[model samples]
Target: MGTKKYRRDTLIEAGLLFSLFYLPGYLFLAGIPDPRSFNSLLYNLQIWILLVPQIFMVIYLMHRDDLLDFQSFGLVRPGAKDIPFILLAAAGTAAVVMAVQVTIMLVAGEVLPEEPLWKLTKYSMIAPVFISSLLTGYSEELFFRSYLYTRLEVLDTEKWSRLIFVNILFAAGHLYEGVPGGFNAFILGCYFSFLFTRKKNIHIPAILHGLYNFSALLLTLFL
Candidate 1:
């Protein structure tokens, strides 16, 4: 009976965490008139800014439950050894994203639309883009990769099942950017999951995720 109650509590906590992290995205999707425009970028930044308090609350709850530690979440101070893994994770993300696009093109004969997925209408938007990338890198990884994955492990979920389950939601969360964006996000989500699992370091994956976003924004700016 105690075991049953514990499992129920775990499930409840995980669900609450998930909703807390993602509910705003769903609620605010309707507000962006053009997803590629400068205004859209600012809107995303605002969402992250507003989420600061909620993020702190979520962290506090996770700590209170003793669900994670500094090492578990890769919150420790880094050394030079960590740099290579960070770069590799970022490169792996790019490779996976490209591979997915190529596979879709070859199999379905339809090109995934890129314009709607990333664009910046003005040069002045660069600073906000960087800020958005930084926030996205750490925040999303905290929720999607570290917290959700840890909870699933506690639930005794199968490894592959956990990967697929988390990435599906990760992808779904990006559906506001359109189907292509969601598809890319799904693939990259899988890559980042693998990185975190192998390295036992969320910080590396977070930095990699940030680099990828920053690169995408730069590509839109120059190319």
Candidate 2:
């Protein structure tokens, strides 16, 4: 296929993948007594159930993209130089997120409440959270950066337009989190997209993404 045709096909595939992951969550949230309420176990359970399908869809999409090739996914040893930078970026991002969360709580003059906080720190939950972060980091990078951005680059005919389109979709995916979260995620997505385009690797962004989520979980627990 021509590059343009390939990219258009890839974008359609990505849209389908995103819809599979998000539609059910939207439906579940629709039924909630208070969509934003953190008090209901049933609501939480529904969210968790929605995540299962999302994860599976991500895996299938990544596999289809050939981005899940063991070496590409960081299953092999990375160069020594790449390792240190990746570690530093991940750690730095996590620290910044923690700082932001603390600032928010202080400004709000209230805590995150016990139940949701406990969900983050509980020993049994730690393993699952870590695994989920790792998987999600890999999956999102594969879909958004490797597949979607690469395809956009092929189709847009102009570099800046490709960047803008990719960032918009990246931001849109985070809309469920509210405006601030979507904006922040979009800004972060731009950074990651730039990194991927420059470095020609997904490992760094995956590490950063994982660390960002892990840091958010830590704030949920300890702050």
Specify the poorest-scoring 10-residue window by lDDT in model 1: 30-39
Over 4 Å off, model 1? 1-3, 27-33, 36-45
lDDT for each residue of candidate 1 in 90-174, tens digit (9 for 90 to 100): 6777778789889778866866563445577678777877777777788888788877787777678899999999999888877
RMSD of each: 2.9, 5.6
Report the number of backbone clashes for model 1.
0
Against the true structure, whose lDDT is highest?
1
The stretch of ten residues in a row with the least summed lDDT in candidate 2 is 30-39
Per-residue lDDT of candidate 2, residues 18-137 (tens digit): 676644555564231332222334444554565556656654555565323533433334577898778767665655555645654676554343343223545455555665666667
Off by over 4 Å in 2: 1-8, 23-77, 91-119
Q: What is the TM-score of each candidate against the true structure?
A: 0.84, 0.66
